[model samples]
Target: MKNSITPSVPARGPADHEVRDQIVAAATEHFSRYGYEKTTVSDLAKAIGFSKAYIYKFFESKQAIGEMICANCLQEIEREVRTAVAEADLPPEKLRRVFKVFTEASLKLFFRDRKLYDIAASAATENWQAVQAYEARVRTLLREVLQEGRQSGDFERKTPLDETATAIYLVLRPYLNPLLLQYNRDTTDVAPAQLSSLVLRSLSP
Candidate 1:
């Protein structure tokens, strides 16, 4: 298969490493219930029935655990987008379908792990490094996609592709805003597909 723009994070070990996953699951719960600010190693260890020092053996701090949780969530989004783009089967339309693919993935990411999303948002609002890196990667991906669209005459925006992409990101950002998720809480109003369609059609020639 051809190389794709999927996000990959540092791998720890195997799928059968039950103990590591137990920590991750415990961290996920703690981060969800208490959020980044309030979640502590002792709390996570207590939740998992592990020792505080044992938690340290796997993760040095809450921030490190937060990174693993957020990284796992982001990785899921990347996999979905990669599958959509890879299976579109038409290079000409691959560029256009990427929007749908990415949007679909975003919806899944949003709904599949609201708790982790909340934790990530709390960290992001605090200006965490992993969140900043994810944001930059998002912008970079948008810039590249927009540039491709321009080259193929799919979009007519005259500004530099990166600037244009940034503008578009600003416009469509609220749909994925974590605050909105807090309000909706039930996932009834956020329609990532419709949002993606609106964006894709807006740029269609």
Candidate 2:
């Protein structure tokens, strides 16, 4: 019988969140530079001076790291939208500001980094739950804004709050979708101001 070879596992490092943070930071650079499909655990480990096993200790897989980066990016987007919504007094103004903030931030985040955009695009298709969860958060934010509009007598809704929010989200899909944003760079079919007017009119009492 032939002798079997055993693979050696990397020794564990300090069991602190710092190690995880380092992994994520290094992974972000590698992912942004090399695109998601080309990046590997070994590449990340080599960049960080750790073994692939060490990376696995912090993140279950390369996909998990990608998910973390996506989550972080989405969180930042959410924070900007939330800040804009919170500061605006009028619901129409809040909706407009939120739309502007979301569009500007997303464009800056994705278009400025094509590799990141590619990763996000892949995640939207493959890791759909992450995308859905992010959308759910946005929908909840929209619902809150709609509720405020209703309370302020700015909106006369024939549909329920959740349904109305979903409708708004679907209506704004072209603007909110990253892939569509990338493809429609030169297109002038729908302007931001035009969409804002449509949304305001739709919501008006």
Candidate 3:
């Protein structure tokens, strides 16, 4: 008989945490200036004054680092959406606010930091965990809004809750998706309000 043992990985120490943050911060600046697709791990290493092997010790690949950045950006948008919805007095108003704040927040990102937007676009295209989780949270929010409307006698209860939420999410997908949003920018100014109105009308009790 032979005995086998697994090698245990060491826990990260304070210095390790500091180095990881340094790598991520430098990578963010590098990616912002150079674009995600254009920049390489070697480039980040050179810019951060670190060896490529050292960088890899913290992140298995460039995409892993990118995932963290993308998640942070999406979290920002989600926070804005939540805040806007929270300030509303009614389900109808909350739903409208979701459209307005979400579109505005996304556009702000796209226009303000296009390099970062490129990473988000890539995340959306690849169905990254961050994007997928964002979309799930959004759908859940929509369902909650619809439920509130029904309970308040503001929305029709005939439609299935999940179906209605899915439909609303689909309606807003063009504006929400980074890739689609670029092409849809021409209509961005007025589309969200108009679409929300149309959806709200359909939901009337």
Candidate 4:
């Protein structure tokens, strides 16, 4: 009888999960220290004490590792914005808080780690999955805030929710997008409040 041979597959147990986390952690540190564009999967493997093939077992490529780091960084900004918005009692305040908090968070990130920020900038420019997902969440949040304002009689009910949200998102995009943020540094401190005020006036019922 002929023996049937099956291809070997990587195990997905707790140990494997730990190793994957370790790899991601290592990659994040490496990318933060040395810009993502200059790093290679082979370099990462050497830095992390793993073979290139073994690293591939955990992540498909260097970009996959970057995606994880980028997603985590974006999630942190989203969390701060969400928390600040939740703390405000009025819908207008919530909307203003969203702009203020998000801009502040982005600025903080840009200054703290320029190298890491470059990854986010690249992700934004490329419209990577992480950036797209982050943008969608922000849009949803804006829509919800507008809906709440209309229901509370603080905002006009004339404009459609999606359209209003998109409009506001476009206004905020320069500050929120990493790729465009560096150019707007001079206005970062004052722009969010001014823009939010302008938006609030338009929304006034």
lDDT string, candidate 2, 22-95, tens digits: 88788888888888888778887888799997677777778777777777787777777788777888988887
Top of the candidates by TM-score: 4
Off by over 4 Å in 1: 1-22, 29-38, 89-104, 112-114, 180-205
Q: Report, for every candidate in turn, its global Cα lDDT versus the true structure.
A: 0.62, 0.74, 0.83, 0.83
Clashing pairs in 3: none
Error of 1 at 69 (Å): 0.3
Q: How far is each candidate from the true structure, as Cα RMSD in Å? A: 4.7, 10.5, 8.6, 9.3
lDDT of 1 by residue, 2-48 (tens): 33444333434553467777888877877777766676778778888
Clashing pairs in 2: none
Off by over 4 Å in 2: 1-16, 187-190
Best-to-worst order by TM-score is: 4, 3, 2, 1
When summed lDDT is taken over every stretch of 10 residues in candidate 3, the lowest stretch is 1-10
Candidate 3, number of clashes: 0
lDDT of 3 by residue, 106-166 (tens): 9998668888787888898998876777788788889988998999999999989999999
Q: Tell me which of candidates 1 and 3 scores higher on TM-score.
A: 3
